[model samples]
Target: MVNWFWKRKRPLTRTLRVRSRGDYGDVRRVDFAELAPEIDTYLGQAAYLQLGFFETLSDLIAPTPELSQKESLSLAAGAALLKHRALVDVIRERGDDPLDVMLPFREPLDTFRRATHGARPLETMLSVQITAGMLDDFYLALSASYGATGKQVAEILQADDDRDALVSILKDAIDSDPEWSSLLALWGRRLVGDTLLIARAALGSQALDEEEEARVDPVFTDLLGAHSRRMAQLGLDA
Candidate 1:
């Protein structure tokens, strides 16, 4: 069942507004040591989510006989696995147990998956694009606030192959059936709504400070802008 919240048609900026100030937060510098634990936890959840996405993709592609399509799917899944391993390695290097760090997130992530489970291939792809893109944007914000280590992990997490592949598939699908464009645009909106809701619930649990809260609107704006660009790239309404 789709959540009622996913049906909301509010603009992203309005939905994600942290406060009425509309002022961007100054990028406060943070050392790796200061944010290490939080970063580790965030990366662990990200790694787990990526692996889950691959598993979902793998299942979807399993019965397909097209070699080229299979190859692309495999490559995307392989990239996700590589990202997972990199995140785990970083967590271990930080002297933290990766499993322990990710444990708290399992429930929320699982809930998100269940809530946003797509009924169609295009819907699934849009969900993947929105979820992965939002995570990347969040990491980018962290990288800017934190130092070199955060930057390194953000860079490592930055892989557009899967998104690019999905976009191609979406474009082909929509082009073949022009009527699909409208449906997909709606699906994309639902995906974005659900994703942001899940993100807010997860991050809200982390108890962000005043400055961190102040950063929310700007990061959300960046994310929404990226989503718009992606939708435009695929010839879908943002």
Candidate 2:
């Protein structure tokens, strides 16, 4: 039932650069103190969105003993809440108003959610997964561009416990209904596309270099590769 949409002919490891020291040589160093407000803005909105998504997911999943004991849906929701609080804490520590920091991004994030509303729990989970993974890549890519605090926030935002739980649920769902593989695969693709569009719009508003913009396509290709691998792991076609 695994239908691969495309296969990468060559490896992409070298194509997509992470936080390598060499890449930072010519790049202008972003002052953490100056950038802290914007950083908090980004993370706060992200934390709010993720927490809401996890809360909705917690309500959607059936309370089976296996799911209850192992995944503990409430734990995922709680984790997301805590992450939001932590983001707020980061903002407060920087002496910024958390509400003001997150206010600008609220509209775009809401619009994204409204535009990409899923019809099923599986699709919802996949959307979360795609967004989470892409954000991780984006943060990691830009980690060195900012200062040490930026790196710290990037690492903090990279937590994937809730996403991991969603993945387990997705795998189990696919296993139970192999016939849904094709549909789910299509959903995954849609999620990836929508996520990228939203990300582009969001990050485009930031001050990025021409070099960074040029590097986006290759990094996105790497994201697709990672998404494909994740789909394959769930016995779905990429």
lDDT of 2 at 84: 71
* Each candidate structure's count of clashing pairs: 0, 2
Most lDDT-accurate candidate: 1
Candidate 2 residue-wise lDDT, 88-151, digit = tens: 7777887888787777666666666655556876676676666656655555554544466565
Residues 99-156 of candidate 1 have per-residue lDDT tens digits of: 8877777766777776666787667767776677666555545554335666667667
Clashes of 2: 2
What's model 2's overall lDDT? 0.57
Off by over 4 Å in 2: 1-41, 61-71, 205-213
Stretches of candidate 1 above 4 Å error? 1-37, 63-65, 202-214
Please state the error at residue 237 of candidate 1 in Å: 0.7
**TM-score for model 1?**
0.76
